[model samples]
Structure formats: structure tokens, C-alpha cells
Target: MTSGGRRAVTVLSGFLGSGKTTLLRRYLAGHGAGVAVIINEFGAIGVDHHLVRMVEEQSVLLQGGCVCCTRREDLVRTLRDLLDQENSGKLPPISQVVIETSGIADPVPVLFTLGTDPVLQHQFAPAAVVVTLDALNAAAQIERQPEVRKQIIAADWVVVTKTDLAPFEAVSRCRMRVRQLNPTARITVSRLGDGSDALAPTRGAVRGLPPEAPAAPHSEVQSTALGFNAPLDWPAFGVWLGMLLQARGPDVLRIKGLLDIGDAGPVVMNVAQHVVHPPEHLAAWPADADGSYLVFITRGIDPARIADSLETFQRAGGRADLSVRELA
Candidate 1:
């Protein structure tokens, strides 16, 4: 959020019921700097954004799945607006941008955006994706959800939360599981510790900072485009998607992908718990590709495990087959 200099975008993502909102509220209040937040919620209702008790006009609320593939344009637009405000002296000198992606969000694409988008690249820097892992339910969720895997794969920092609710042994196990999925991310364990605990009060003027790295090509990061590849059968995909949902919705961080509704092209994949949205055929595949594919960003979940469960999805369909993977 360094004015004039490029900025940084930090993402906070985790599984459902992991107490992410509570931690985020604490961070915002105690951060003591000009920070804007981007909230990505699962439902059209937009409950999470309202739940965050902050008063910032520049904040953007995106009601959908992971912001990476689902509403990337929204991110680009929001950054531009924030930059404009900062330039005009209408807003405080900003320091950082933190995003609270949907519980099922895979932070990769959103993080990838900083390195990819042309305009955004000039004005912003890519901070590490900070993820929270629920100590209580992480094990089961990892076993069942592909979204969980994506969350972990994309994380540069993994925070283990809700240790107070878990037994001592449970906390230890949670840490072990987090390591299996991400060997490189820096991990911070917080049971009752919230954002307020992390940030100390500060009184000072913030200076603008330039981006850490040069903007790379956007296509290199966003090569994985699923739903645009081919037409997907609504009923068939539904059945397969449902089975995965039933087996792992609790583990789901946030589900966003492309689907084939019918003759209409953009049968979208927008998921939030038990309620999965039917396909809303858009004009065409977002970038005009003919084959439709599915990609997932998960935490503590394995792509192979997810694929094996949803295999009942081929058109000929003796027994369907499907798989979910984490994008680098």
C-alpha cells in the first residue's frame, strides 16, 4: 500500500468454521496502518463482509468463490480504484492490502494475479498467501475436500487456529498434517490469539514502497482454464460434484470452477456448502476456449483423493472419473 510505489496484496484463507473472520477483525483493528481489505464470500447473501466490523469506503466485497478464477476482474478493478484514491490524496498513505478469500479459496490465483495482470503488476506486489488451519476439524476436512488441498498448496504461511477447542494431542496432529501438505510455508499456531494479539499500537506516518519483483507474464500463471475446454453435461457433472460435496463439504475451503450447463457455454461452478448453484450460461468461455476443464485449490487435501471420488463423470459414463489439482 505504499502510495506512488507499487503495493502488496496478502490473502487470508482457511477452511470453514476456522474462526478466520474473528482473526481478520483483530488484524484490521490493530494493524495501525492504511490497509484495505477484499472479502470473498461463498454465498450471494454476503454475510462475511457485513460481519467484518470495519468502516472503510475503499474496501471491496466480492460475493463468490475464490477470487482467482471466479472474479479476477473485480480484483483488478478494485486495485485500480484504490490506487486512484491514494494518488488523489483522498485516502491515507496505504501500506498493505489483505484479502479474506472464501473458506474454500485457493490463494494461488489471487496471489498469482500480482505477478500476472499487466496494470495491477505495475501498481502492486505479491505478498505471501497466509492460510489458517482449523486444529479441530482439519484432519477430516483434509481427508474429504479438494478445495482444502488448494488452500494449502497456495499458502506461503499457514496459521493453525482453534487450538483451544482441540485437545493437546489434536493440536500436535494438526501441525503434522499441515506440514505434509506444505513443506515450505511458515506456520504460526494461534488458539485463542487473534489479530489484536499480533499487532501492537503504532503512531507514525507510513511511506510508500515499490513492488518487490518485476511483473511477469500473466499467461504463465493462469494457464489452467477448465470449464472453457468443452461442454459439460449438467446432470452428469452435478451427480459427480454432489458426491464429492457430500463426502467433503465440511472440508471444502471454497469451490469455484467452470461447468457446462447445456447448449449455453458458461455453466458456472459456484459452491457454498449444501447449496450448489445451477449453471448460469454466460456468453461464452471466459476467454473463448472450447474445452471445459475443472481446477481446484485446496488445503490439507490431496488431488488424487478428490479425483478418485468424483470419477463418475465421463459422458459415456460406465463409471464417471474426475480429478482436482493444485495450480503452481
Candidate 2:
């Protein structure tokens, strides 16, 4: 539980055959105590919940629909009921909640539901989004499926599973593809569902950008890394981001960075589609980060246009000399 007494919620998402259940089952093996799980399956019958039930007894199943669309209200009511049970001694106290989404589901709507709900917003706080990527089929799946790309983009930590079955080169390429789609996610390799470390509650920090990789074949998703030479006006940047998301939320897939808002330390920013999480202010900057930098994962948008708009916004905020450069 967080200091605010809210239970931490982790959203597990992946495409079909991405090893989501395998990784989740492994995670629940050792951390089942004080943890509750909600499994969402698209079909009329739920099978994943049964697999998870082997390790955890406090599990709920939502069937016949995807959590992102038809099952959102069900998700709300289930969470409330869990709270009621814990309060009344019907179930053990839950410190963490894991929501495993179906293969075709988009995670942004789940996050939106949690943030916007009246009772849920106060009782639950987002911990992290862990996504599973199949090492052998990720390249083809990412190229053909928009759902796979969205899952990767919304992930905070992406676990590349089935590494033992895939060749070394295939795993390398899979990691590169995930980096292309979501530059901020921490990528790790796992064999036989041993990537439980990915579920650790720590957020993946901005460890400077990796070497640039060629654009994925037949994909419009591109990541642009921008560095600001000077501190930005936080209010002005907020306005610009708000208007940008309002206009092009779908095109702008993800935005994550550490910003120097003329404070003693940097302010951390994370966004998925149109949902902007509350900015975290640190007492000091991390040793690795030299200055403020933002990586934007976008589709069908020119990187130059984004840089120009940010520069224009900063200038209007009285920082005319604040130069924004695209990192190589």
C-alpha cells in the first residue's frame, strides 16, 4: 500500500500468445499474500482466472467482454466489492491489485476508468503497467496488429518472454522493436516465465536514450527524443500538452520525460494517449540525467513539427532563448 493508504494497481496487458499468463502466474507464486487479482477474458468462459487461482484464492473473473470497452463498469463494481469484503472480514486485506487484460484490450481505457471513477480514484493508485512481448512473433505481430503496438506503447516495463525458444538474433530484434515503439519502457528477457522482477513497483527511470535503431518495417510509430537547454515554464508546457492531446490524442501515443521546471530537481511526466498522470517532483535529479529530456512516441506526425510547437510555446511563456534539440 502507498503512504496515502491506497492499494497499488498493476495492469498486465499483452497480445495473443504473448505469455501474459505465464509471467503473471510466476509473479503470483511468491507474492500471493495480501494481493488480489482481476482477470478479464474476451470469451464467455474464463480460463486465465483458473490458472491464477492455483496461487491466489482472492481472484475475480470478468468474462464475455474486453476490459477496455464493455467490462469497465464490471471492473469498478468488482473493486468496490473487494473493498467491502476486506472491510467486513470476508477477504484478506489487499495491498496490491493485479488486473490482467485480454489479448485485444487497450490499457489506456483501464487507466482512464481508474482515474475518473469516484470511489476508485481514492482507494486505488496506479503502480505500474507490465506488458509481455513474445520474442519469436513480436516483429510480425507488431507490424500487423495495432493492438500489439498500443500495448507496447502503454507499458512501463515490457517483458520479452519465450527467449529460450527464440534465437539470440530474434530476441535482439524483438527488444529493438519494443524500444522503437516505446523508448521509455525497461525491456528484460525472460525464459519460462521467470521475469517476476519486472513486476517490482519501481518505475523505470529515464536512463539516457539508447542508440538509434532503424524504423520498424511497415510501421508509422516513431519515437522522438527532445532535450531542452534551459528550464521550462511548467504552466506553459502544461497548456501546450493539454491542447496537443485534445487535438491529436490518438496520434500522440506516449510522452515521458524528466523536466527541469526551474526547480531544485526535475519533474517527472508520463502520459499514455490522453491520460496525464500527476507529475512527481523529486528533491534532486538522477545522476544519469544531465538535463531535461522528453521522448515522444507518435504515429504519422513529423518530429520537426512537435519541436517547433514546443519552441513556440516556450517563447510565448517568456523563455525565448530556450532551445529544443532533437537527440540523435
Candidate 3:
């Protein structure tokens, strides 16, 4: 379950031939009991939805246009229909909802729909955006299609597919690019469709990295992780973060991390677009964890600018000793 009692929705996205269907089939075979699947395709007919329907009956198809683009309203209507079915006892109770976007789609619009639609927002919560990356072709794919960057930036987890087929150097390059593109996204590799567990929903996920000046924003978006060693003054840091998000929320795709606020337990922060989920405070830090870490996935913004602004605001607010570094 997510923050509230609402059912969670997971967005499955990837480039063409990135193994989204393989992972989805496996996920359904293992854990289809209370899940509703929606497959959107940009083809004339719904081949994948048909394939998925063979394994799971609780499935729907949105075809002919990209769900993240022209067919978004269809997505909204379909989601409402699913809820109506469950309400009328036409379908089993839905514990979760998963939407698989067309390989060419940009996930940001769908995320905006989820965060903005009042009816959907109340009934369904954002679980995670899980993206499949083809290790063999990821480096070239990123170079060829700019949309691929947005998919990675919006992802909460990236599953590197076809690692066995990819040479060690190819896989290595893919991993490096994934990290450089989305420093906070949890990445895992899989062969033969196993590792679907990484696609599952997580609660209050957080990660951070040491600071470094990134080259100019790669593509239209870029990501980096920022870490600070000292306990930050809550008000000072909060104000700085709030101002940044307020000013650039649209370009700031996602931000999440754990903060060390001295007296309090580690605090978990999450922000997507303009929406800031209530912060979660854990009882204690994990034994190996230390300091505060934040990951930022952004567009049209430089990591150095963000880091500089953060330090400036923090100092202006009188928290001078807070050390800030960007993850390499």
C-alpha cells in the first residue's frame, strides 16, 4: 500500500524490445491474484494486450496511439472503468494497477495525469515507474531517441534486460549510462525474465550520492544524487528545498532521499512534479547508513546550479557547516 489507503498504480515503460512484456508475463504468472493490467500499444491492433490477456483475464487494451500522448484520455476512461467493474463486482478486488506504455511513449505526461486528475488521484496512488533498459542496445538507444531519456528520468527502478546476450563491455556501458542518467533509480540486471521483483512497489525509498559537477544536461534531462554529512537545520533545508521545487517543479521530475535532522530519526522526503508527499520519519537509521542523501532527476537545469543554490540558501538561513556534494 502507498501513503494513503488508496490502491497503488505502477507504470511499466521501456524502449522497444526492452523486455517489458517478458517481465509483465512473469509478474502475472507469479502474482496475478489481485492485479489489474492495462497495456497500451501504438500499433494497429493490440498484440501485447492479447498476449497478456491469455495469461490474465483482468486486462484492457488502449491501441492505435501512445497512451502518454494522444490516447491519454482513453487511459483515464479505462482506469475509471476498471474501478467501476470492481465496484460492481464484475472483477476481483484490485490490490494494484499496472499500466504498460508503448515503447515510444514519454512517461511524464502519464505521470502528470496521475498527479492531476482529481478522481484518479483519490482512488489510486502512484506506486512506482519501472523502466526496462536493454543492456545490449541501451547506449545507442539513448543516443538515437531522446524520449528514452525521459523514460529513465521518470523511472523509480530500471531493470537492465538481456545482460546475458550483451557483452561485458556493452553491459558495463549501459550501467554507466543508466547511473549517469538517473543516479537515484535502483538498477538491477536480469536474464531469462527473472528479476521482476525489482518492479514491485516500495515505500519511502531514498538514496544519495557524493557531489560532482555534471557535464551540461545530457539530452533535455539529467539526474544526480547529492549528499551532506552533517545534520541539517530542518527549517533552513526545508525552505531551500521548498523554494527550489516551487520554482522548478515541472522540470524537476522526481526527488527523494533520507535526511539526518539531528534529534529526529532519518526523515524520508519525496516530491514528484509539484506534489510533495508527506515526509516519513523512520524509527532509526539502518546500521550502515549515515548522513543525508537526495537524488534529483531534472530537465533544463544543471546539477551545479542546483547545488550552488542549495548551499547559498542553506548558508543564508544560518546553517553554515552543512557539507554538500553531488554523486559522481
Candidate 4:
């Protein structure tokens, strides 16, 4: 664990043949000092763990199930065991734990297990969800596989892999699709797992929001960017968001924004489905940030409706002059 006594966990997820292993192996090559890995495979035998073991000795394998489903308890147990071993001096002190999930897994359940488990919550803190997308097959896979879309929507950073083999147009299309699915996720390109830096722990880095992409005709997921012309009332916004998430949690895939609440800096908000990360208060706004804005990734929800709802809620909260406009 770090000096704070909590081990930072990064969930690595991607569809089959998306080069998840390559990225993990590359990352461990340089930063495997105090890292432990938990590899979950869908079948009876686990093979990825052995490959990763070449670089890092502290590795555990969970076989026969997906971490998101049947292996959730297994994951919790593995984590608890790691902690126990560290405490008892059976294993070295682990500062970071990397959970490389099966290709078909949905990462949301893994996060839920970590956040809700009474014992694990205090020992582990989520660092990031890094996903890999194959440039050659991303568009087709995203269109055909629901899991791929879910993984993309849930990612904190997405790496488009196999760019060297795929044509330039295919890579561009894949990036566009990812942007449409998760506007706030940082997207990077990689050839032979060169984009391993995306796995590095973020330290309140200011990520400039990507320009909104046109909605894909074949995909149900869409992103909406909303800008507030004035500072917001924090308490009122909380109430509005709480009610909204309670009512339509599943439909809301991701919510990320920087809110100006009449403070010297902005409040950073990140939400993944029902999981609401604690809002971070920055000392000052980034130089590039012009004003408060929010990006919402939703399915089967109208962007205009969301804008109207927020405007109504803010108006009711005494911000009659505050205008909520959909950013172009």
C-alpha cells in the first residue's frame, strides 16, 4: 500500500483480442516494484497470469468465471488474502493492485464490489479503469457486442490498440466511436502496447474535454455537453443529481463535469452508473477551462430533455438568470 495505507487498484478490461495483456505486460515491465496482479479468466484454465508472472512475481489467478459475475466473491477473497499476506509478512508490501478482467467482463461490478465491501473499501481505493480497443475490429465489435460498448462507457482511459495493422481510416473511426460513447475518457493510440502510460495513476490532471462527436446511427449511446453561464448552487445541484440518478441510474452510463460553485476553483464530479465518486475540490481552475461544463453519456435519453430538466431545477433553486445551453 501507499503511505496512506490504501492500495490503489486499477481495473484493466477489454474485449477479447483487444491486446489487454500486452498493455499490462508493458506497464509492469517498468513499474512492477510493489504491484500485485489478479487475473480473471472466463474458462477453466487461466493463461494470462502465467505470462504476466514473467514480469511480476506477485500474481494471483482466478479461473472458471468472469470477475464481474461469478467471480466477484473470488475477487474480494483474493484481495483480502493479499492484504492478509502483506500484513503477516508472507508477501511484500503491495502499493498497487492491478485486476485484469476477462475480455467479456463488465467492469462496473468490479468497482461495485470494491466500493461496497465493508472490509475491502477501507483497504483499497479505485485508481482507474483502463480499457483497450482493437483498431481493426472496434467498430464492428462495438456494434455487435454489448460488452464492448459497456467497457468503453465505463473506462477512465481507452487505448486503441493494433494501430499499426489497421488502416488510418479504421483507427479514426474507432476513436470517433469511443468519443461518442464516453466523451470524458482520455483516448490514446498504441502500437504493440506502447500506450501503457495511460495506466499511470492520475494526479488531478486537467483533461481538456474533447469536442462532441456526431451521434452514430448504429449506436444507442450518445454524449451531451452542457455549459452553465453562471456559478451553481452546490446543495441544489446535489439534490437534483441525486434524484436523477435514483430515478434513471442504469440509463445514465457516465457523468463528468467541472462545476463552478462561486469558489476559487471548480468542483470535479465523476459518476459511473450508480457509483458516485467523491467530488474533488481543486485549488484553482485549469488555465484552459473557460467556465463550468458537464458531459453526460446516456442511452435512450434525449439531450434536450436533460438540458431542460437541469434548467428547470436550477431555476427552481433561485438561479433564474442561469442559462443551460447545449455546447456545440
Candidate 5:
């Protein structure tokens, strides 16, 4: 264990079934001892812990469907344990920490907690928010899962996973979609989470003014989400979203909502730049609400124009099957 260098933490995140675990396993094999891993899994206790515990020297586990809402305290406790071990000489000084978040976990809260949490912030240095996207399933999942969209939008570096299985044509299309969602992210395509360099600064992890400040103001590009109380016709709303994405996906970083439409009591909707998936029907709203609610997040874009497009969608008769090209 080394004491002169600062400890780095990397958030390995992605949509469900993305190869995050495999990536961590690979990274750990290459790097020697003195690194700690914390794995968080969704629901019914994490199986990843039992499987990987044998391989790694030091590791902790947190299991729950939603870590942000329920198990935040667990993270603090585990981190403290690692630090204490480091101090006692029971373990080698931990040089780096890598957290594999549950598929549905939002990386923002994790990063914020890492920086703002008084106890941990003082001890650890922010490293990178590394996200893995399945070259085969990422586009469809991004469209169907709001959680997935947030993961991509919040990433500093994105690894296009499963590239070997995808043809160049398809991989190129996925990369294009990712660019529209995150214009500034460093993207690398990998078959097994391989990328150049061992260290990279994560987005949002670095706080404070840079050497050169941006010429534009924050208002020039703002992201906000709006919610709806009632559900509109699914077919009609689909048409509205279709037209909206086609017209402004480049400017719209993300969209997420749960709709109450017809028999689709609870429909999960997500949209990133060029990719769209059929709405996922969740178990039902928390209550028996009869209306649909929607939330949209956009940046450097005007909402009034989007409103006008929605109006046009309703006027032209809803076309649920509408599809369009990805906007640049």
C-alpha cells in the first residue's frame, strides 16, 4: 500500500445487464493488491458479492433495488470500514476505490455524496465516472429506461461494450446516438471495457472554475424536467414524443416519465437522442390515478417550440407508429 498518492474512486455504472461486473473483474486482475471494490446490486440481495468475493482481497456489498433511496448509509459505513483497515495495517493502504452501482442507480447522487459528504470527501479524491454501454442493447435501453438515460448523461467516459458482436454500421449508429446525448463525454469502444490510460478525470467530479472560464452563461444551456398529472392517449403521446425527438433530440439531453394511459396504468418512458424503444409498462402508479404524467429534460433549447410541436401532433391526428431520422 502506498501513502504518498491520493486515492482515486471510479463509479462503474450502466443500464441493467450491461457488463459492469465483467469490466471490474478485468481491471482488478490487471492491477495488483491495495485496491478495494464496493458492489451494489438491485433487489433480493446481490449475487455478485458471493461470486466475486473469492477473487478479490477486500470487497463490500450493498443489496437493494434502489440504493439512492434506501441504502445511502450503507455506502458511508463501508467506505469508513475500508479506511479504518487501511489505517490499522490490517490491509495494504488502499490506493483506489471502484464502486459498481446497481443497474438502476443514478451516478449523480453517488458523485454528490462522494464530494459533499464531510467524512469521505476529506479522505478520497474523485477519479472518474466510467459508464459501460452495451453495443447491442444500449440504444433500445436508453429509450426505454430513464435511469439508463441519466447514466449516460452523467458519465465522464463511456465504454461502448460488446463492440465485437456488433457490425461497424450498428456500432457507428450507437456512437452517434451517444454523442447527441452527451456532447462532451470521452467515448471509447471496447469488447471488454478496455480503454487507454488508467486514470481519467470524471465529469461533474471536478468542481471549481477551470483555467479558462466558458464564454457562455449557464442559461445558454439549461436542463430541467417537467411532470404531468394525467395521461394522454398513448398513441397520441407517442406521436408527440416521436415528433419531439426528431425535431430536437440534439438539444434535448434526456426525457423520462411514467404515464397512466388506458390499460397501461404505469408506463415507463425514456428517450435519448437517436434511439427510441417501446414504452415499458411498470406495475401501476403508486395510486389509482387515472391521468398520465410526463417529465422532459432539455438543454440549450426552447420549450415553447416543443409545446407548439405537441400542439401540431394533436392537431394532425396521433400516429403512434411515427419514426424519424436522428437530428444532428
Candidate 6:
């Protein structure tokens, strides 16, 4: 929720066949209560919303143009309509809103619309950005499409789908590539019969993740996840992070991690380009999870260099070895 007590908004975006609708279906089935959903599809006929079993009355569809492109005003108007309806008691009070963008759409433009639109900004706050990546085709898709990079870079959480259909090596490479593009996004592999929690709105933190300039050099994106058993020095880490962002904002796409900040059980920090969302403290470490798990996604930047830099900044003396044989 925003400081004004407005409903939070979550944008679910990904490339075509990335299992976005599938994830949205599961999310609606489990957590649709008091939630308003906006679905956008590129094609003229919109069928994704029909797949959702409930909340037909609360669902709005924007078809033809992608929400981030030609139909942007429609999106703004639709959001306003939803707000007016709730205020007039025409529709049930919305505790939250989830927008599923057309597969081809870039989430950043839509994010700009929400953040800059005076009316919607006051009534709703951007809560999270969830992106789905197809394990079977992500490697090729990333190579062929620049939109994929922007989608991953703007993501708060990335769900890797269709792993069962792809070879283990292919899946590993795909996941690694995704991490490199958006270091801060929490990535989880999706398996058949996976639960709805994967798509549920992530609580805490409200900040925007803007895309990098279009002129970034052509290079393969890379990701590395590091684990630490001890608490991180927040002050030292802050200084290092500020310097890193200032120096290499374009090369660094995203950084998302759960940190053991001493007395606090765990705190989550998300950084995208130059923006750093306020860290959120979790109630406790996730089940069976120990210490901190930090993920970094970068283009033309080596994970080893980043690890070494952190060691230097924190004055930790020795460098920690990161086993890159598998995804974290």
C-alpha cells in the first residue's frame, strides 16, 4: 500500500508463450479476493481472461494495441474507471490490482504511465513486477529479442517456466542468462503442479525500475547468486552499492537479494539501474533458508569482479568463492 492507503498494483509481463496466463490463472484461483485484474492481449480476440475461473466482474480487458504502446490511454482510463466504480460502490473495494500485459509489451512504459499519471498514482501504488521466462526458449528468445531484456530488467521476480520440456543444460544456461540481465530479481523455477504462491503479490517495497538506455553495447548478460552465512555490514555495503551504481549504472541491470542485517531476521534489497527501493525486512528467513542469497545480473560485467569489489568495500579481507556450476 502507498502512504496514502491506496491499493497496490502488480504488473505481470513476459514474452509470448512464457506461461504468463497460466501463472495468472493460478494466482487468481488462490488470491483473487478483493483484487481487480486488468488483462491486455495483442490479438483482437482476448481469451486469457476467460481461462480465469473467478472474478469475472472485477476483470477488465484491453485488446488490440499493447498497453504500453498505442492503447496506453485506454489503460489509464480503465484504471480510472475501476477507481470510480469502487468509489461509487459500483464495484467491490479493491485491496489490490494485478495487470497482465500483452506478451509483446514492455512493462517499463506501462510503469511510467502508472507512476506519472496523477490520478492513478494517488489511488494505486506499484507493488511488484513479476516476469515469466520460458526455460525451453529463453536462451534463444533472449538472443533474438531486446524486449526480453527489458522485461527481465524491469522484473521484481522472474518465474522460469517449461523446464521439463528443455534439456538440463539448456535450462541451466537460460536461468544463468536471466540472472545476468537482472541481478536483483528473485528467480524461481516453475515445475508442473507448482502452487499459486509463485504468482501471488509480493508484499513490501514500492519503487520503479526504469530500463537502461537503448545504446548499451551488445553483450551476453550473466547472473550469479551468492550465499553468505554472516550478516552484512549495511553501512559499508551501502557505500559500495552507491559507488557501483554511480560508476556502472548502464552495465548493471538489477540486484535483488535477501540480506542478514544482524539483528533483523532478514531484509530484502532490490536495485535496478540507479533506483534502490527501500529494503524490506521479512518476518523470518524462508523455510530451510540460511543467511543471505544475493543475485546479480549484468551485461559486459563479470560476477567475479563484483564479488571482489564487495570484499574490498566491506573490508572483509578474503574473497568468497562462488560455485557457478549451478543456479542458486
- Predicted structure 5: clash tally: 4
For model 4, what is the error of residue 105's alpha carbon versus the real structure, in angstroms, after optimal superposition? Answer: 0.5
Candidate lDDT values, in order = 0.55, 0.79, 0.73, 0.79, 0.58, 0.67
Q: Tell me how far the alpha carbon of residue 142 in candidate 2 is from the true structure, in angstroms, after superposition.
A: 1.2
In candidate 4, what are the lDDT values of residues 1-328, reduced to their tens digit? 5324688888889999888878877888877778888877533333334223212112222454233322267677788888888899988788888888888888877787787778998899788899999999998999999999889988988999999999999999999888878877888999877988877655422354534655563367778889988998888899899999878877888888889899999998878777776677888887778788888888889989999999889989999888899998
TM-score for each model:
0.52, 0.87, 0.78, 0.86, 0.55, 0.66
What would the per-residue lDDT of candidate 3 be over residues 151-225, giving only the tens digit for each residue?
Answer: 886777889999889999988788778777776677888888888876566651454332343444456667777
On a 0 to 100 scale, what is the lDDT of residue 302 in model 3?
Answer: 86
Question: Candidate 1 on 1-328: residue-level lDDT in tens?
Answer: 4324656566778888776666776676566367777776643333233223222222233455433333356577777777788789977776677777777765555644455567887777554467778888988887788787667655556778888888999888777666555433456678575633322212110101111111231111111222222344566666777777667654554344545544645554434333343334555555533444455434455555655444436444442223333323
By how many angstroms RMSD does model 3 differ from the true structure?
A: 5.7
Report how far residue 63 has shifted in candidate 1, in Å. Answer: 23
Better of 1 and 6 by lDDT: 6
Clashing pairs in 3: 210-326, 210-327, 211-325, 211-326, 212-326
| Model 3 segments more than 4 A misplaced | 42-71, 208-223, 233-239, 245-254, 261-263, 271-288, 297-304, 318-323, 326-328
Q: Write the per-residue lDDT of candidate 2 for residues 173-233, one digit (tens) a residue.
A: 9988888788788889999889886765555534544325345622678788888889999
Q: Write model 5 residue lDDT over 128-207, tens digit each, in one string.
A: 67788888987688778878777877666788888888888878877776665654456778875575233232322221
Error of 3 at 51 (Å): 12
The best candidate in terms of TM-score: 2
As for TM-score, the candidate ahead, 3 or 6, is: 3
* Candidate 5 lDDT score at position 313: 63
RMSD of each: 15.1, 4.9, 5.7, 5.1, 16.4, 8.4
lDDT of 5 at 260: 50
Best to worst by TM-score, what's the order? Answer: 2, 4, 3, 6, 5, 1
- Misplaced by over 4 Å in model 1 are 1-4, 42-71, 195-328
